[model samples]
Target: MGINTLAFLLFFVFGITVFYLLPQRLKWPFLLLLSLSYISFKDIRGIVFIVLSSLSVFLGGRLFEKRNEPKDASFRKKILILTMIFNLGVLFFVKYVKPIYGAFSGKTPPELDKIPFFDSIIIPLGISYYTLQILSYLLDVYWGRQKAETNYGKLLLFTCYFPQMIQGPISRYGALSAEFFKEHRFKLHNLKFGLQLMLWGFFKKMVIADKVGPYVQRIFFSHKEPYGLTVVLGLIFYGIQLYCDFSGGIDVIRGVSECFDVKLAENFRQPYFSRSLGEFWRRWHITLGSWMKDYVFYPLSLSRPMAKFKKSLKKKVSRVTVNRIQIAICDIVVFLLVGYWHGAESIYWAWGLYNGIILAISALLTDVYAGWRKKLGVDPKRKLWDNLFIARTLVIVTVGWIFDCSKTALGSLNLLKNAFIISKTSFEPIVLNLVDWVEIAELIIFCAILFKVSRMKERGVVVREKIEALPFAVQVIIWVGMIQLVACFGRSSGEVGFMYANF
Candidate 1:
């Protein structure tokens, strides 16, 4: 069920309440049951796939652990390879088979109905999310870093943990397993803070994201073909919508889990505050970037071939230049995969390369830019310099979103070209033409609130903690007002489900 829906809210309330009342021994079991129930409710047809994937990882982990001997090294390697193939292959075919097939074939592939067991299901719910989670578990086990759960059901519970299944922070096994199996007691502080966080999340998603999303999408793709500032305005609105929708959903998920004293990995920092594309990625979707770094980038960067290349480069270039060259190569590969993982579309691929290339350029030019800045008497640490970089980074990131917001690479090019061109629509009240002034005003007010909140967070302010410190009656009044804001202005962020859920 969509987390933004009232029905899911009721479900969460009922589940958490019953969870607290359950016996200590029964807590995890009840949670497993609820998680499975959620899967069953979402797509009964997906039961077979989820079971097979989780069970394979669980058994693979057991087999790997048992065969931990020098003599069994070859066997262990084979097991890991086969298990990864099976898990990833299923994920790929289940999720991308149609688009990928059509991409090459130039025609619609045979209907999925012809495929066994996949007839009724397209992409299985959480298939994209849980696949990475389980793979991380399998890899950790293979590397002898973490122990596999002896009980298959417990491992299954970890994979199907309901709160994070919708759109994940892509948590690691060691980090989340403790939170899952820990002895959790109900605390009034958890309840208060959790609810407070959820309220803020609702404010972001309903008050701003949902309100801005439709209008942005309409203007962006409208036949009137918006240009210049109209395009710029749409891009900003889209950026806001994307962040608030994804992060707001994550906040709700985290808040609910926190109610159970289960701490999920955080998915976002103040990403927009980042002054570099590298920093933006590190800050945005914090878990996904970390996952790629740990699983993809580091491994590739340290591979024997890379080691050889790095050694070869040292003979011809400075140590820093050698590292930059290695970084450029590995980053290009990582970001390409990152893009393809987002979609099979050329636009996504281009966006991925744009980030990878820009980051690489920034790295390669680090010394050059610093030298120029020094010569120009521009202190790199100056506030003006930092703000200038921030602005530049924002523009770069927003340009990448044009690719994301478009249907094709060519479409992205058109949008980018028009995004900069002067036209009659450039200074017009184009957004007001799209929606009423009341909505425009509401968006302004909410966005200003969002900016203030984000600024405070960037400075490490705990806004929720501040709210918690308020008098009980004052807190009640605040909650009531928050609820009223959502009630009156909410566009139901989940009316169409979260944007990231598609990925």
Candidate 2:
């Protein structure tokens, strides 16, 4: 079931209740059973996939731990390769096949009713996320960074923890495994903080993200030629909508884990405040970006071929330029893979390329930009310069969102062309027509609230702590008001699924 629904709430409630009541030793098994039961609602095959994948990784980890001698290094590498191929093969087969099949046949992928004996034949829940986790764990074991878990049950729980199975912050074995097995006594503070975070998530997803859905749909999904301003506005709305939806979901998941005294990693960090495309990625989807940096980017940069390429470039250019070129190549490759990670779509490729090019240019122009700023009497540390760069970065990011929102790469290119076409009609008429004046005002106010909170966070205000310190009645009022806001605004949106779930 979707994490936002009442059913999942009830499931979480029951699981947590039974969890703390049990003896310390039984906690892991109890949670394991609960996770299995929760996922089984999708279908039986999902359980099989989780079981087999877990087993494969478990075996791989064991092999690394057991055979990790200096002499058996090549065999350990073989084990790593085989494990990666098998798990990633499953993910590619289930997740990527449908897009390819659809392209050739011009029909939707066959569903459970059309196919036999495999109702859950679709990509098993969290395959994209958990596969990376498992891969990370296997790599760690092979590299001697961490020891593999001998306990299959603990490893299983680590792999399929229910809350993270939704949309993950992608927990690491070194960071999360100890937390998983630790005994947590029940605490009122934990419950209070967890519920508060979860409520905040509800407000973000239901009130803000879903509220702007129709405006975005109007432009992005329209059959008629879209207005230029309207398309740009739609892309802007989509960027906000996606951030709230994905980050909101992570908040809910983290909050749920918190109730059990488990701390999941934070996924976001005020990304809109970033002044560069590179900084924006570091803040937005922090876990995924960090994952690629650690597991993919660093290794690829330091690989033999890259080292050889660096040697060749060093002979042709200065050392500084060679380093910049090498880094740009790695950054571009990482972003291309990141884009493809979204889906097997050309539009996503364009989006990845767009970001990669911007980042590479930013790297290459560092000295030139610094000289220009110096010559122009621009202080890099001044607020005006920072604000200007932040706005510029937002505009660049929004343009990339056009590709993300479009159905195809060509459609995005057309939208970009149209955005600059400058039609005679003023944007005022289009804006007014999209919603009532009251809603238009409310939208501005809602965005203001979001911006104020995020800006405070950017300044390190510790908002939740401040709220906790307020008088009891004021705290209650705040909670009640937030719930009322969600109840009023959230109901009309019906069921709004998260945008990133497809990825």
Candidate 3:
């Protein structure tokens, strides 16, 4: 069940109650039970696949460790390779196999139906997320960063921890298990903080994201094709819709997880305010970027082939040029794979290349840009300079969203080209005639609040702590008012699901 739903809320209330009531040892097993139970509610097929995936990696880790008798490195490498193939193979089959096959065969595969495993092409919930966690665990064991888990249950708990099992701030075993197995007392502050975070998430989801989503979908998919100024408006709203939907869901998940005294890693960091495309990525999907950096980018950087290439390139060019070229190569490859991770869609790959090429150019031009800025008497600490970069980055990111929001690469091009027109959009008549001005006003006020809060966070203000510092009665009244606003506005948002859940 989605965390936003009433059923999941009730389930969570009950589960948290049982969690706190249990003894320390039973709590984790009970958590495992809850996770397994929750996934079963999502799909029986999901539960079976997750368990199988978990077993494959868990066994691989154990076997790899065992092969370390006299450190038989080759056998361990073989085990690691086979294990990666099995796990990544599953990811590829479920996520890519259908689209790739459908492209070639021009029809759905009967072979998939013939497989006895699942009834239909049902991709498991959080397969992309959990598979990353599982691989990270196996790799950690192989690298001797940590020992393999002797108990499958504990390992499974790490693999399928419910909150992180959703759209994740992907965790590694060494960092996560320490938090997982530790003792947690029921603290008033933890509850207050978590609930407050959840409330903010609910506001973003129910009020902002859900409200804007329909408008975005309608405008993007209209029979008239993409609009002009309307296309700009739709994409701008889409950016807001996407961020709140994904990050808001994450906030709810992380907030609730915090009540258990386990804080997941931060996923977002005022990404829109970032100064560069690279910085935007570093802030947005923070964990996924870090995972790619550690597992993919750094490995490519240090590998022997890259070493040889760097040497050859340095012979033809300056060392600085070589480093820039290296950055270009690695960033492109990493982001290309990352794009493919989402799907085999043309738009995704185009979006990936778009970002990669810009980031690479940004790297190559850094020294020149800094000197130009110096000559222009531009200082980054000044407001205008910072805002300029922020605006530039937002435009770059939104341009990528043109790709992300469209059905295909050509569709994206249509939107971008249409975006330049000054003519009246056909969608405006519908917007004016049918739109609710009251709801629009509410959106404006809430958006203002959201921007103000984000601005405060960017400025290093701890907003929740500020709330806590207010008079207790005042805090109660303010919270009561905000909660009521959410309830009132959110009711009209209907049951719009989190956008990233499809991934």
TM-score for all models, in order of appearance: 0.95, 0.96, 0.95
Clash pairs for candidate 3: none
Best by TM-score: 2
Global Cα RMSD, each model: 2.3, 2.0, 2.3
Q: What are the per-residue Cα lDDT tens digits for candidate 2 across 241-266? A: 88888888888888999998889998
**For residues 1-503, what per-residue lDDT tens digits would candidate 3 score against the true structure?**
78888888888899888988999988889989998888888887888778888898899888977788755988888888988999899888888877776667654456545656533678888899899889888888988888999999988988788887668878888888888889977888988899888898889888899998877877787566655777888889889999988888888988989887788889999898899899999999888898899888998988999999999888799998899989989999988878887788888898888888888888888899989998999989999999999999999998889987787888899889988876665467447743577877888898899899999999999999999999999999978987997788885634667777777
Q: Which run of 10 residues does model 2 get worst, by summed lDDT?
A: 111-120
lDDT of 2: 0.83
lDDT of 1: 0.85
lDDT of 3 at 401: 92
The deviation in Å at residue 259 for candidate 1 is: 1.4
Pairs of colliding residues, candidate 2? none
> What residue pairs are clashing in model 1?
none
- Candidates ranked by TM-score, best first? 2, 3, 1
| Residue 496 in model 2: lDDT | 74
Candidate 1 per-residue lDDT, tens place, 425-493, comes to 674647446767888898899889889999998888898887778898998998999899988899844
lDDT value, residue 322 of candidate 3:
92
**Global lDDT scores for all candidate models:** 0.85, 0.83, 0.85
